[model samples]
Target: MQSQDVARRPAPSSPAGPVVEVEQAEAALVEHYPRLVRIAYLVLPSRMGRCRRVLTAHSLTQRALPRARTPAPAIPSRPAGRDGDPGYALVRLQVVRTALEAGLPLRRRAWPKRAQLPSPLPQVWGLKLFPRSGGADELALDQRLSALSGPARAACVLRGLERLPDGDVREVLTAAGVADADAALAEADRGGAEHRLLDSAEFDPCSLQARPTDLLRRRRRLNATLVAGAALAVCGALLGPPGDGWGPDGAAAPPYARNPAAQAALDPGRLTRVSPTAWRTSARVDFSVWPARGDLTDDTALLRRALAVWARPGGSVQVSATPGTPSGGPAGPPQLLYAGTVDNARVVILHDGLRIARYAEPADGTRGAALDFARVDGAGRAGSSAVVLGRTDGNVRYLTAPWVRGAGERDLREPGAAATDIALTGGVTPPLPSPALTSGPCTSWNVLQLTDGTGTRLVTDLGELVPAGLTAGRPGAAEAAAGAEALRTWAPFACSLRAVRSAGVRSVNAWAFAEQPLPDAGGSAAWVCTRAETWRGGGARVLAQFHTPGGRFGAVTARAEDVPACGAREPRVLAGVLWKSGAGTWYLLAAGSRDTVSVRATGGVEGSARGRLLTVRAEQGARADLKGTLEDGRTVSGLR
Candidate 1:
């Protein structure tokens, strides 16, 4: 690049430059310029037209790339792939942050209040690595991009296109002036970019054509404006104050300077409206005292709540406080206390402690978990609360502090948690109730059980518990133990009874399979349980359980030694419970010392284990039957 080009470049401020560091930074940028350009173009298209996007992207990339700032010491050389390298990830995240910042101020232009027609698709420019355009609707994709505010759009692009995880996504979004990082993720999910992003083919960078002459002209005009403004400032300082000003103190002319009638048309003190941006800058206002109206001045809770709302990161809230007139005596400036983002800096309003509003910003890691805020009472006694903030997926987190560090009396969610929506009931006592846990649904449970052979292992799901003394060498016990383990691993445990759907009109159906990783059973064998459920009436319930000591892993191909006796030729039924909510059919079979009869079981599979397998069967009108197998191999089938 020529010396003239360097002088004219509009990159953001850099550290005091040495020749060696500058060269290295420049080299690194030039090497990955294409990738950086693509990132900026995708995120900034709305802010600048296609032609300008190219020029502006180059400028932002220069400003954003970490190496471009302080290459020698601060940033390491780019890694082979950024997937695993923390340094590379941080650098990329910085680019995203800078890009978001650059676009936030210009989002309104891209998304104008008065409806504007969408630009024609631009032609592809420097790169072709963008994904092929297919499987997604172009119009819908465009709408999704348009709907997002600048910060949310940056988050979606970085997460979907860059594949950065939640932590990185949160950092970039928070730095980009997004009020809530989780909310931004939710916005991305709603736009269908949570998993996939629009392909590179969808973006047409070259459609917007720009000439060098236009940029040169615009730069020249900007220079002229700055010069004129400087000249005016110097002239004003040199000139004497105007004699005909608002007051003798020489206060600047009001907004309606041109027309005296317009200035006097409305009461400037009583009525005032401010833009969201204006609230961020520090300023003082002399508001009207409307005691009858019962506004901020008359209500302490409302005032404190409003201050907390405005204190959120990237958040803005307008406030109007009544200033006393000469009749009430001289009014002191009301001190405004806000929670700062960089540190836990608390500003106390010593003059009557007019404003001691407390608030907390959403954050993560150890620092976020242990954050604390203090609340000073009227008597100077202080109460503080520890803040716990975390979120799953893309939603705002509402946590309750069951106990505070020093003030263990009240349960609170930091001061700012409920500040966004506050209601004052005009009672002296502060309302502090038990905090509710916001850690999502309580269905999933983790249970650890001791396996006789080795270390303790995790049981995957909830199921019927096996009786004690069921172990190896015990008749009909090892099979039962294995069956329970299998059930824990694979059965779909439903929290509510309503979740089970009626098994179609079939008499008996295999509803689910219970399978567990085998310990000593050879490479291909696994302990499996085939659960059959009965469908009658309007609901379905488990009817019989068949446990296989070791079966082929997928039931696709089975070996001779894998299946037990009952499952060898046909499906098996073990000793299991059979009950219905109302009227149902039942049958019993047993072996006795003398009685003998021919019997055939349709749905039940026979097991080889020999032990007392007790069962009960009943019908609405028929008497309950009792059956038992005698010590001898004879049959005592059924007794009613």
Candidate 2:
């Protein structure tokens, strides 16, 4: 409760004491800010947590200066200290003293010190800050220091950070109001860390790594606000004049706004409706040329409801979007592709250049309306022509492009099966089957076979607003899956599309890159690499599948996301899988594209072979690194 230590040597310039001016102390704090903050951070108790310590350290250092010119303790910091400024020594001591006080616990009987309370300045929100992490040794040292008392922590900081001798540390600790400076010094010397470790960046508050706090929580709160706002707007619309709303928009709660862009997006009159004969005369073959179909296209009430819902859907609407597809409203007026009653629900399809949006409401009411979005950027001729209209029971209908002459459904599993005719009524095909919508076991994947001027290609519904095109063969030269050979190639891996069901896939291509002879005179195996290209260009997924002669379904050996491995840009691929022989012994089987000159395995099992194949004995479930050298002498790692 009492101080026993005194300053041994006062500043030589001042006879009475080290009386410092406000400007001098301010200058010292600014010049040595990082070092001073580091000392305070190390001195503060670990219980304060890293984020709080960061703010407190800065607060203490800034509050260290005297109000006016006043006398400071005439203490000599150290003999050979790097900081020769007396101002720095005075301010450093003040920072350490206040930081220690902040760590003291509040008592009911005693009022706390000003420093003990949370610092009012340097307030931070929505982010957590921490010192840059250090190596293991620094972490160990930090744990050791955390066990020490506040005064002992100050002693260690003074001795290591300021390089002060034991005597000087004792004097500083005593002046900082430690009850027993000798005991504090003893505790620090016994359990304290290596002095140099205290200087690590882990203890520095000036350098920090910052990250947002509770992002998921923030997003949930934002969504809740939007829902509340929608409810309020609906009430206002009912009570207010009819001119307030564009129309009675079903499932579309127009947000409370007067923004010009929002008004333009909600207005049905501004929607672009292409003529039924536009695609025949247009140069490009994409959704932009598709004619607006459906009997409800001329109904302004229904059209207004669809546009308003598409622009700002209510919380009650079941909104779904394929992965990587933007669910936000169109940037400007979007083109109307179709608007009509399909099955028991009224469906409307709208297309922006990047994505297609479909809105559907129950035939009875708008209570159970649904909205769906799918990315279709950069679509080409082929199967990009048809879009799903609505699904009734187990059957799905599609609104096709005007350029298409006939429509049919083909079961991909049966390569030679006769195509079943799906009669088209005003460019809308009758519901056949939707494979992506099935659950339980593997059955059949039927795709819409559209026969246009170019040729017939297959488009499969992927549980989105739009369907993805199917193709087979080597990367850049892949053709439509309508051919017998292409159909056979797609049959085995057709179920693998489940992995990328809602991944915004524009097209999927299967390529049989290699047929390798199994180890120990076993049957040959087919190595196929399949890629699902996304409309966003970046989310392509590649999988290396291995299949035996009689295997009905191929097994995926390796897979990767957002990589160009099996695409046209990078056609070469290498993959390895551990196979169990009839005798139960494990062998590492690997294969690469025909361009591969040699294959090698390392780590758990090591082997190298000329040409594109490799086989080596390996422990069961053992993992090995595989690589291949192309004919051009470039190395490629095995797909993972």
Candidate 3:
């Protein structure tokens, strides 16, 4: 039965079939295990011990691949056709490589540890061989490897180190070993410009060593100091000094100290006392005395008060002494004597009915004697000039200088004619016209007289006044007539006149006239006039006639425009007459002129008549008519 069962088992297939399958699987896994380990290394580079464990497990799996007892579970079916198996393997390899490049983890142990070892050659070859997985894992692995000393650190860093791109890696390795190889691994995956990537890798180790920790700390301290100093400076500037008082330059001078007291006791205008005898009374008088007897020192108050009594405007005081028997000494009545005080001195007044004398001396020996003389009658006038005892003809003729010898007197008389009793009491002066008044007709007139005995008078005519002057001739007579007709033309409106003269002129031409105030009212009024001759001479001429209330006259020549005119050239001369009183006084009387006529009857036919007469003639021809009363008062006459 065993022979027959064996015959039916189909002549056992070669043992090699299962062995070939195992071998193939082992080969494929071995080919890919390094890449898987690289992935695991990238993912857990900081846990290198774990990565080594994963790599070990992956190696074990590969080894066990060749020892499988039954066909390995159909070698997991692939998505592609059976013919695509090799391609699938290749694709899987590529995927694992990409994962390694992306730094993904894989289930591997010792392989990852082995993969971390550095290669000696330029990394470019290794990079091409396992470009994706090996390059990245190598950098991370190298960073861990850097912890080892010398040869070990060098071995790991340089192993795959040269696989880096072109730039700074070479230079970096020349100076220092890689200290942060993991960062290099990250840079490699990013695929940055090859030179920049390498440059960064190259400088990484040195940069770590070169960083200045102390300098950073110092910079922080400096910043803090600067901020603190700035704050202090600002606080100082704002708060200023701490006390309430003036600074060094008097910036806060006390204002209260500068004001003066309102009621100061010292008298500013009084003179300093020179001697005990020199004294002043409250009445503002200074006086001194000589030949004084008892010292005035103890009695200053009493003396000052005594001086005040006499200093009043209308005070009178007397000094007398006991009468004594007469001796044949001087031929005067009993010599009247009195003791009095003058300033700080004791004084004596010796009086005769006609004269009085004052003598003073300081009670103390400090001052000299003084003497003063005054008339007893009290009629003598006090003056700056020499005091005359009487008029030049008086018997008691004496002249004494006031204080000084030659100070002259000032005359205070006002000038003008003296007023007569009638004029003075009546308050009016009699009117007197000029003896040489112009014959026939006069246009205008003004008169002035003086009040004192100076006897000055002024008279002026009121005609010939012109607007700009006669220099600007009158408008055409027709125009003048028209203007006159347009308004009511009157003789008084023709011109204005004023005259000023001295106390001598007796007669003058009739012209425009005006009366103006005396320059000073105390003086006489000035009568001013402009003569027809002035206009005819082609220039303005003014006569100044001065007159006093006493009826005297004088003449002076002055420019006329300086004198004011009335109606002269004012366009509208309303019906009015201007009258001037005493001086500088004027009034306009609204009145018209009146006319007077005288008539006489001659011996003739007796007649009385009243009728209107008329005659008519051509512009160029002459016509005549006559009418009158005959002696009998009947109508008479005719002409052709």
Candidate 4:
């Protein structure tokens, strides 16, 4: 009876795991070679230099496979969380252990470990290899990593590169001879390492740039240098003194070598400016048919300076662009939309079909200039209704389309507020506060009201060259943002547009998917979803909001990036939020579309309900997860 009872009991947890075959480890090492090297590179000390680190990382990863099958002592409860293969797990652990040991100081009292010395194989001659330079963020991350200790660096790499949890990290570190796993994890947490930066190209040893080692100095004795110098001398003597054409380029990308196409692109007189009546006769109603308008349209010197600055802005110029938009020189001479002296700055607007670029310079001098670009690739009549002219002090002025018969400014939050008529002088509207720059609260949002042949529409500034269009109703069949009903619907969510500011947003639409009756007879609440579609055909953002009765604004309950949860193609969305009723009772309220057959809550609070709604009584500070079954038998998780 005792023996049978002992057999029924489960085996105790062991520190050692099943041994993996050498062949299996070799396959994993070959398949995940790049990822393993990147982990090693991140764990190694930055002071080793990129070239040495790259080689050393490769060497450590290659040597990770054991000569024979051995027990893997760092197995977690779930293998799927770590590549689902014991071979991959074993190799990764060995690489991390070796990388950590490499960063330790050499002890003079005893012979050094093989990992502490420089790598011998995979060396490149006469060249220094390193990853391409990244932006400011990458530099900051590199400096932060360099300040951390060896074990701390390994902990961070495991957390970021391997995406491992603290429990697994502790197991792997302990199995690798780490004396105090908790101490390493604490040091890593205290360093405040931004884990996202670990995936950037700056730390990717696989993507590298190789520059000649001392080649510039060594090339003095080469015949090719003599020939290049002699040729340059002759060309300089024949050209004599250089003109403004060859002068210092402020901030423009220089051409590798001069060509006729590039020269024509930089010429101001070559810019295409269609006639005033061209749009009427043209077959395509795009930027190409719009006539150039402004007081300085015919100013040759001003046009030349604008073109020069547009081609290559100097170092003093501040340049920016909307998301997914390129801020580079045009392929050829772009069409001029407007050129004029607006307020204290000289402004020029250009259109190349795909983008709208605004170039602005101080009236006194071009010492301080700013260049901004926004993508408007397929803009037609309604989409191209307006372009931002000048933005100053958080105030923006717009140049309406020629077809825009009238323009006005209205606060979306105040649906009953009187609209202020904006006088157009040469088709330019006066400066008004932009929602993109509003701070502190979501009290008010100002939108551009344009009246054209198609009726009235609403557009709001999001710190871009082209204001984003606003609409209402369902995704594909949404109508223009007009009428009192549309204004009231947009009022509460108008401030939410700030989330997608400078994201190359082409349009946004708000849709009411479901209405649920609150618990304890707290009155019904509305569930609204807003989707922002960008010009680049991707990166659509969706937000699920919960609006309670008598609340001035809806609270954002769930959000997702680049998902189809609440977009045109996929209109169905499921979400839940914790709410405190006016009577001081806490409840977990959830709602979904009519298509959701049943909704359920799990974890902190448990409940199951039929149809598209679920309500559960919950304690304060409770955490829960939610899901819903669709009519088609598919399950959907709440957007996060």
Which candidate achieves the best lDDT against the true structure? 2
**Model 1 Cα lDDT, one tens digit per residue, 1-640:** 0111111112332222222344544555566666666566666635243455555555566654453434222222233453343333334544554555444321333442111122233333343222223344654665577667655667677776666676766655554345567877776677775334444445543233322322322454466569979999987865547664434445667655655433322222322233323322424211111011112233344334323332321213211111110111012322332222222111111111222222333211111111112112221100111111221211112111111111112111121111122222211111222111112343322221223222212111111111011111111222321234333333222121111211221111222222222223322222223322211122222322222343212221111212232222323322222223213444222221112222222234232213433323433333322233434444332211
**TM-score for predicted model 2 compared with the true structure:** 0.60
Q: Where does candidate 3 have its weakest 10-residue lDDT segment?
A: 464-473
Residue-level lDDT of model 4, residues 299-390, one tens digit each, is 87877776777778777776777667777788888889999988668899988778888888766456567887888888877788889988
Report RMSD for candidate 4. 24.0
Lowest summed lDDT window (length 10), candidate 1: 461-470
Judge candidate 4 at residue 177 and give its lDDT: 54
lDDT of 3 by residue, 460-545 (tens): 21211001111111111112111222112112222222232111111223221223333224343323232223211223233323
lDDT of 2 at 492: 82
lDDT by residue for model 2 (1-640), tens: 1112212222122222567798988888898888889888888877566888899998988888878886655556663543456677778778877877777655556766778777789887888788988999998888898888777888888888778888877766766667677988888888756888877889888889886754434564477679979999998877687574556667754657466876787778998988877778888888998888888888788878888888788978877777667778888888899889897688989998888899998654565688888878777776468888887535788888888899888888777897898789999987777887666587778888899998988888876667889899999999988988888888888888888776778889999999988776678989999999888789898999998777788899999999889889999999999998767879999999989999999999899999999989999978999999999989999999
Instruction: Rank the candidate models, highest lDDT first.
Output: 2, 4, 1, 3
Q: Rank the candidates by TM-score, best first.
A: 2, 4, 1, 3
Q: TM-scores of the models, in the given order?
A: 0.25, 0.60, 0.12, 0.59
Candidate 3: residue 620 lDDT (0-100): 24
Candidate 4 accuracy as lDDT: 0.80
lDDT of candidate 4 at residue 336, scale 0 to 100:
92
